[model samples]
Target chain A: MADRVLVAKLGLDGHDRGIKVVARTLRDAGYEVIYTGLFQTPESTVTAAIQEDVDAIGLSMLSGAHLALVPAVMEEQRRAGVSIPVIVGGIIPEDDIPALTKAGVSAVLGPGASAEEVIGAVRGAIDRARREAGGSAPEGEPGGSAPQGEPA
Target chain B: MTRREEWQKAFEKAPLRDADFETMSGLPLEPVYGPADDEDAEYPGVYPYTRGPYASMYRSKLWTMRMFAGFGTATDTNWRFKELLAHGGSGLSTAFDMPTLLGVDSDDPRALGEVGRCGVAVDTLADVEDLYAGIDLEKVTTSMTINSPAAVILAMYVANAEANGAKRANLGGTLQNDILKEYQAQKEFVFPPRPSMRLVADTIEWCAAEMPRWHPVSISGYHIREAGSTAAQELAFTLANGFAYVESALQRGLAVDDFAPRLSFFFNAHIDFFEEIAKYRAARRIWARWMKERYHASSPRSMQMRFHTQTAGVSLTAQQPEVNIVRTAIEALAGVLGGTQSLHTNSMDEALALPTAKAARIALRTQQVIAYESGVANVADPLGGSWFVESLTDEMERLAEETFSYLDDLGHGSMLEGVLQGIEEGWFQNEVADAAYRFDRALNSGRRVFVGANAFTEGNDEDPIEVLKITDEDERRQVKRLAEVRSRRDGDAVERSLASLAAAAADPEVNLMPPLLDAVRTYATLGEIMDRLARVFGRHVEQPSI
Candidate 1:
């Protein structure tokens, strides 16, 4: 079965062009992508992520509220007892990357991230989470497989 | 042979370079244009306004250098405003933060990390007072980019200016009170489309009677284009929204001329130079013709379409940050050549974060260079007669007209109804999403070349620019300030004013402006006022779609 990923836009920023394109990119790469639309709070985003039972969550934050919002999402994930790997992408600055990473973000993609970079980040995060979990892939999902077709 | 035939013969005799001769929007172009291509000979300040809005464009007065600046708290942004004025910025354009834009207070739980993040945070009239501080409201025109809470913000501005001894009539500026685009592009809407549009029409009606110099609605295509729409989509959707606003105002029994003159436009100056220029020209022509013929607007001022332009923020690449200055310069030049009334250039560091002071200065300087150093501003519509430009303008008009026809049929011949129905059906959102996906696919497939992104990607890893950061302290201080204002103000007055505002909101006949002004004067917070209205108007939650 293909890996399922949930992409969400948390916070009040409505700039969804990046997030929508990323969703399509992931879906085109054979991942069953579910997108949570605009104005989603961190609590709502994590709830959707858990409900979807996806392999990973991709958070798109362009409002410059990532530092406060992303950590809140991480905390929500912990509270909900879901150890889902969360990757973020948007207009994130270089200085904020370490902090986001330190706060348990698996990968941080910038605005100019290409399709390969986005796919690589998601796959790497999922792989890292699997390895950390003693190579136990999610129930019926295949463990180590490349995305079907490379983005042309 | 005539001059046209002779020029055609000469044009064919000369060899052309082996290149794709087309406008950025892919409209094919000819090597040279002659009198045969353009025979209208319309001058500036004429009917249809295809050439330019004013007779002596830019030669009499250059376009206002309005920089969009706001971050952290009111005091922080006020300092930036003064600095911009000191640096010769002709006008002020305010950018409210997410919470404020969403009509919530700094302390609201929904605000969480968003307070004072994207733009300035305003809780009450006190924040507005601090925002303007020493800036003379009468001398300078300010444009507030707020939509759902635009009427509330306008009330605060009016109360603040009056408290500062500024007459309401003498005060000048624009309010981006356009709500249709909010449902279509920017998702900061608080109430549903019907009530939200009532707020817009109320503001326009109020401004027409009270603040003549104030522009009630800046029908915007900037956010639409930024949301990944094509150039033609941007033009068509924006003009359709403009027509909707006009219809809304007319429905309110206001004469077309009474409020149409105050209606303005805002467009995105995307990287496609000729395409952006053509969009602006086509915008004026379409607006003029529609207002005169369809709306039966008799006044020439009502027919003219004056717009403010901002350089496309989406075109700025995050890979080579500094190279954005060149991109901004080209876009700003397009705005000036397109005869914009005001302009805002994006900072080099904006793709990552809010612009640092230095980056903002460079962006402002980009506009200064175009206004003074570049000779493009000297001639009104310098590209008006070019074969490529004229043809592109006409093509843009045709494309926009096609969109209007579809919308008209959808609305049963009413543009306003069409837009409202389109928003409900998610047609606009799907169209924009499809366009954005196509662009991304083209970029990924190497069909579209973005410098330093898809091509010429050497040394793209270095990040040298310093981005301005809004610390948590700003948010905390803003919350504390809101609390203090709440505690100090007369609690009874706040309750009474909010009650009256709510009552007025329940009644469709009562214009919400006066009650909003009364509420803001009582120090009722934006959140309180919005919540009261939401009780009656209801909150809007869009049906999420990919």
Candidate 2:
């Protein structure tokens, strides 16, 4: 089973060069990546993440609206009962990273992040989410088969 | 063996180690350049223009130092404009905020937090007035960098200029109404390619008849390069787009000579010094030849390629930010040696945020230094006879012709159809993406190096550079201003004007500028006019291809 990751761009900023590189790197690392192309809203991103059942989601925003857009996605994901971790990346200033993390972002990758660093972050984030999801499941459940690996 | 042959043999045996020995476009480089390697070259201001568009080049008049600037509110930008002019900035290049570029008013909910963050915010004709207040529109040439809503913005400019008692014929400036590049690279397109192209044609036709000194469309490859493309791809794709616009105007019954002279170009001055120079030279030769042979234009003005070059923003590094100053200086020199008519040097801090005033001043000074101090501008095409530059220029021209032929075939012997087909099939975007991916992969693998970014470790130095920050309060002010304008304007006039625009849009033969100007004069917001047009011409849905 391949680890499925969903990548998305939020808001009016159309800078996808960084996001596309990240997506390609993740895909090359054997993840089934679903990319939500530019100009996606928070609602559309959350809907796609839930529908795809992605193991993890990555959001990239270069426009300064990340503080507003990211929390909206976090809220939508929470309402949809999805615990999938979402990583954010772009030209985020250092001061805003902690705020994004506090708003439920798993990790924040800024400019100049190497491919290896991005892959390591995404893989580690998914592994941590899977472990926590596995530990919280009821014992002896039919669907409780080791869900560590991606169902896709 | 002869002494030269022996020297060549020794050089081959002990070649430079661990070096790629190729240009960024994958063209192989030789050990040395000499007269024997020089290609046949034409003189400057000649038919082909392989050397340059003008015979004297910068000796007659220096290239205009047109810096792209805008941020915060319109009044804020207006102040910047006045300061730039006072500081010897030759021309104005306007940059709009995301909402205005995306055809949304500053007050829209989707525009929250993004308004005035990237560039200036202009919601209605009132904002445009404030933007150009006290500046003589007739004297100072302005270049507006808006695409999706370019018609609305241009209409606003024309209306504002008229209101200020400036004759349309006396106005001089360029409208970067290039919708093709928006679909291909900038990704700020509102309508589909077909109708968006029609709107561009309408502007060109209107300008050809009304505004004698105005450049209706600046076919741009700057965004395509900024989006990540090779120098060759930038040359090829941008010229293909120019050809597409020419065809669109021709289809509208305008003669080739009528608008081609006013047709300008915008290109990115990437850090590759020799390559960027060759790209510009090759661009002139290719455009001149095509305009004469293929398009059958007899006018020499129509054949010459005049362009504005901006130092590549993508090449700037956030790590060791000040190193970008040197990069911009080199790129500006390349643009001058390549015979650009106008140039903009990017601020070092752009990768982090909109440039602070200090950084922007440094950028303008970089251009001024090149213009005044750099003796390289004394000669027209100083590298005209250089074996290496001439060969590269020839190779680039040949490669661009190949791309042109491919697009022509796709368009069924029409560059217009080829561009339309390319946009619909995502061919242009895919090509740029592939080049970008290759560059990124090479950079990541250490096959290529970007001085401060990929190499030359700074060890995470804590150098605190002041970045220009646009606060949420700016957005609030912009929205309030927009609301005030809406409250004051006559609702009935706005309604009638919008209906007229929608009607004009529905008819294929109707030129949209008149009704568009009418609507803008009624204080109809950018989004209102754009929304009405979108109601008639459906919004574009990008065919996602990663």
Candidate 3:
């Protein structure tokens, strides 16, 4: 089954050309991508992500609201008791990447990351999360492709 | 044999990248062009103004080096503005942060962690005062890039200027009070289209009477191009909006010449060098001809299409970040050759975050090099007579005219009505989305070559440039500042001002500027004023364009 990923744009930032591009790239890679269009709140994003039962959530923000908005998505996912890996991409500064990653973002993809890089991170992050959650995965080895539904 | 036949034969032998030879917008290109395909082009500063807006063009003086700079707190951006002025930047263009752009206060929950992130945050007149600290409003011209709540910001600016003893008639600057384009491209709108247009008309009408030196509205195509529109679409849509604004003002009983001279334009100088130049030339021609022939404007200034150009933000890549310096230089050159009245070159590091001081300096230096070194500015429209350029200009004008006719038909002979209907029907948004989708497909398919992106992906192991980051501490500071301002100001006065502003808003006959100024003076937050007006005008909830 194809891995399902939810892409969302949070906050009042309307610059979505890059996010849309990333969504198309991910969908073209055979991932079942669901895009939450512009002006999404963190609550709405997490709700859609968990309801869709996607393997990973890719949040894109360029209005410099990532620090304030990304953690809300992380917190909401935690509150909702969903363990889907969350990855972020946008015009994020290098200094902020570490903080976001430490805050439980699975991967931080900055500008100029290639399509191959994005797909690889989405797969690796979900696999790592599935293993960390004590789901099916071999110890000390990269997991196989993610399932369409929740990992066993 | 003719040049066309020879070029065709040479093309047949040499082959090409693909079977299609066309511009990015699908404008078919000929193998060669010559004088035989010439249109009835006109001279510079003339009726049609095909060559340039000014007869002397850059020979008299170079286009103003107005760099768009703002980020973090108002005081932080104030420092940047001073730094830019110290570096010989002639004019200032301000960029407001997301919360401010959306007509929200810093403390508003919707603002959250976005304060002072993308641009400068301003919640009251105090912030505006801090933004222009120590800068003489009368001496240097300023252009602000704000929509939706543009009037609120402009009022704060005016109140600040008056406090500083700058007379309204003597102040020179531009307010990007263009709301139609907000619905068409940028999507930063607060109220629906009709009320937004009314606010825009208020600003235009006010500027025509009070601030003679100020440009009230700068009809913009920059955001449209940034949103992935074609060059022709940018020209067509921007001018269409411009015509609509003129008609709206005329409906308000203002003469065409009274407000048209105070009107200006903003366009994007994308990476396509010749195409951008031709686009500018065609833009001036179309605007001038329309103003004189269709609108019956007698004055030259009313007919002229003066514009400011910014290097395309969409053209800047995040991969080879420094390579963006070269891209900006080329785009700046295009703007200069195309006869822009002013220009802002985008920072090379914008794709990463708000530009650092070093990156912004380099971007400004890129323009300085073009102005002082490139010699391209030595002549007025140096490519004016080139057959290839002339042909492209004609083609762009032709395509733009077709769009105009389509819009006219859509509006049932009213450009304003057509624009409103188009926004409602999601026509403009869909057009831009379709263009963007095509560009993405081409990039993925390797049909388009963006260096360091899809092609030439090796040997790019350079260290990343340091980027500017707005921390949570900044948001906290802004919210605290807003809190203090709220406590100190007379809450009753704010309520009274907002109440009267809402009262004026309910009546379509009253111009909202005076009451708006009163509200802003009473220290009503932008969100407060917009919210009150929204009660009357209603908020714009865009229908999804799938």
Predict model 2's lDDT versus the native. Answer: 0.86
TM-score of every candidate relative to the true structure: 0.93, 0.92, 0.90
Q: DockQ for every model, please.
A: 0.63, 0.53, 0.42
Per residue, candidate 1 scores C-alpha lDDT tens digits across B1-546 of: 543344344344445433454554667654333244554465566667787777656655789999999999999999999999999999999999999999999999888888899999999999999999999999999999999999999999999999989999999999999899988887789999999999999999999999999999999999999998999999999999999999999999999999999999999999989999999999999999999999999998998899999999999988888999999999999888888999999999888889999999999998888766655565557787788999999999999999999999999999999999999999999899899999999999889999989999997978566778789899999999999999999999999999999999999998999999999999999999999999999999888888
What candidate 2 gets wrong by more than 4 Å, as runs, is A131-152, B1-41
Rate residue B78 of model 3 by lDDT: 92
- Candidate 3 structure quality by residue, lDDT tens digits, A1-152: 77788888789987766677777788878888888777889888877876677788998878878888898888976777666788998877777888898889999887667677888999899778877877585433223223233322
Ranking by TM-score: 1, 2, 3
TM-score of chain A of 1: 0.89
Which residue runs of candidate 1 sit more than 4 Å off their true CA positions?
A138-152, B1-40
Comparing 2 with 3 on lDDT, the higher-scoring candidate is 2
Per-model interface RMSD values are 1.0, 1.2, 2.0
List runs of model 3 lying over 4 Å from the truth. A1-4, A26-33, A123-152, B1-41
Model 2: lDDT of residue B1: 53
Q: What TM-score is obtained for chain B in each of the predicted models? A: 0.93, 0.92, 0.92
The DockQ of predicted model 3 stands at 0.42
Residue pairs in clash, model 2: B411-B418
